[model samples]
Target: MTLLELLDYASVFVFALTGALVASRAQLDIVGFAFVAALTATGGGTVRDVILDRNPVFWVAEPGFIAVAVAASAVVFFSAHLLESRLRVLTWLDALALAVAVPAGTGVAMTLGHGAAVVLLMGVATGCLGGLMRDVVCNEVPLVLKQGELYVTAAFAGAAAALVAAQVMPQGAALLVCAAVTLVLRAGSLLFGWQLPVYRSRPPRR
Candidate 1:
């Protein structure tokens, strides 16, 4: 498989794991786990592909993507109970997914000859949208909407890095750098409790 394709599959597995973890936390059944897992695995890439006018969404073009997601759901379904902290696993898995998905999206956009702006946006969408959908479906606060979270910012930084790196390096190297930047920023936030500053509203006039 091509590096980009490999990254896509890896992201699918990681995102599906996070989705299954959410289902586990919600006490959902096996079907719920599979549904959410599949949605989270492919939602972002589907959105990106649609926007880019790429006929036959990535998962549709390669049914193996769906198979991988289903397999991930099954693995989590049978193994989640052994985890001492599902939340922690979900957080890390989400971070890893973001790292992989950002580069995957950026690489596709570049390959399609899109401008840097579109490339960056596609990267961010592919990294964030799936998790957002998962959280909304699970009735949890979506990480992107949470105050002070660096999720989207990290995605932006990674996408920008990939765009810049692609100008001077091979696509594979650029993708690696993108993933590394995203993973470091996200993991650092999780480890150090780093967050953006929240806006303060002025008092209402009397």
Candidate 2:
């Protein structure tokens, strides 16, 4: 299989794992596990595909994606208690998944001859929207909405790096660079609490 395809599947599995983790935390049943897993796994890619005018969507065209998500849900379902902190694992895993998904999305856009703007936007969407959907459905504040977190910024950096590197390297090399940049920045954020500065408005004519 191609590296891009492998990245896609890996993203699906990791995102689905996060979804299942959230479901377990919510005390949801097996059915809910499956539902959340599948939704979080495919939601971002589906949105990206739609925006890019790729018909049939990804999961619809490839049922194996859904199968992978289901398998992830099952794995988490049976093994959640083994982890010391599901929430911490979910956060880190989601970051890793974003590292993969951003390149997958950017590569697709690059292959389609899209401009850098579209490539960057698609990468951020693919990296972030799934987790956003998962958190919203779970009634939790989405990480992207949180102050100071570098989630979307990491995605943008990766996507932009991929697009720039594609001008001088093979697509696979570009994807690797993308994933590396994303992983490093995201891991740094987690490890050292790195964050963007928040905006604070001054009082109006006090």
Candidate 3:
């Protein structure tokens, strides 16, 4: 497989793991776990492909993607307790996912001759939407909606950087740099509790 395709598979694996982790925490059954895992693993990429008008979504073209997700869910189902304390795995995995997915999404868009704006937006959708689905399925406030560290914002920033860098550097190098930037920024946000300020509305007339 090409480097970008490899990165896409890696991102899918991490997303699958994250979905299984959440489902295990919720004490979901096997079917539910697999459902959530598959959704979280492919939802963002599916959306990105649709937005970019890329026919034949990745998972549809490659049944192996779904197989990997299902396998990941099975692994988590049986060994979840062993991974509880390392639940922080999700945060790190999220960082890696952002790194791999945003660049892959942007690369695909660029390859399709899309403008930079469209490419960047595709990258953001690719990186964030799966996690959004996962959070909603788990009944948690989505990270993008919360007063958490710049999640989607960070992904957009990295994607933009990648798209710009592609002008000068080789595709692989540009992708690596952008992914590294994303990983560093996101991991720092998690480690430092970095969060964007929230705007709260006061109650009106009593």
Candidate 4:
């Protein structure tokens, strides 16, 4: 299997796990777990494929992706109760998924011979949109907008790093750089309280 496909599988499994953990927090039924899992696993890739005009969406072309999502959901459904803090686990898993998905999208765009701008955009979209969908559906605040905790910023920087790395390294090595950069930035935010400054409006002067 190609590196891109392997990246997709890794991201799908991790993202689906986060989605099922969210379902557990919501006290959703088993069917709801599956629904959220598939949604979170495929949402970003589906958008990327549609925008890129790929002939078949990734999960549609290979239904094994959905099988992976289902398996993740089933496992989490039964095991989520054992976690003392599902939210914490979900956030870390989401970070890992983001790292994998960003490079997957960047690699796909690079393989298609798109310019740097498209590659960067695809990377951010693929890394952020799935978790955004999962959080919104679960009525949780989307992590991408969670007080500037470096989610989209990490994706952008990672993709940009990959683009730069491609000049001096093989494609696989470039993607590894992408994943490493993404994970480091995200993990810093989660572990060290790293944050981008938020704008605060001044009170109206009379």
> How high is each candidate's TM-score?
0.95, 0.96, 0.90, 0.96
For candidate 1, write residues 1-206 as lDDT tens digits. Answer: 99989989999999999999999999988889999999999999999999999988999899999899989999999999999999888888999999999999998998999998999999999999999999998998897676766789889999999988988999899999999999998888888877787677975578
Residue 155 lDDT in candidate 2: 96
Clashing pairs in 4: none
* Candidate of highest TM-score: 4
The candidate 3 region of ten consecutive residues with least summed lDDT is 195-204
Model 2 Cα lDDT, one tens digit per residue, 24-101:
999999889999999999988989999999888877888999999999999999999999999899999999889998
lDDT of 3 by residue, 1-206 (tens): 98777877988888898888888878899989899889988988999887766778888888999999999989888887786564577667767777788887877887788888888888888888998999897996776555768787778888888887888988878888778777777877888876566556865567
2 Cα displacement, candidate 3 (Å): 1.3
Error of 3 at 145 (Å): 2.9
lDDT over C-alpha atoms for residue 131 of model 1? 95
Candidate 3 C-alpha error for residue 3, in Å: 2.0
Models, CA RMSD each:
2.3, 2.0, 3.1, 2.0
Candidate 4, 1-206: lDDT as tens digits: 99999999999999999999999989999989999999999999999999999979999899999999999999999998898898899999999999999999999999999999999999999999999999898899898888869899999999999999999999999999999999999999999988788776886578
For model 1, give the 10-residue run with minimal summed lDDT.
Answer: 195-204
Q: What is the number of backbone collisions in each predicted candidate, taken in the order shown?
A: 0, 0, 0, 0
Runs with alpha carbons beyond 4 Å of true place in candidate 4: 203-206
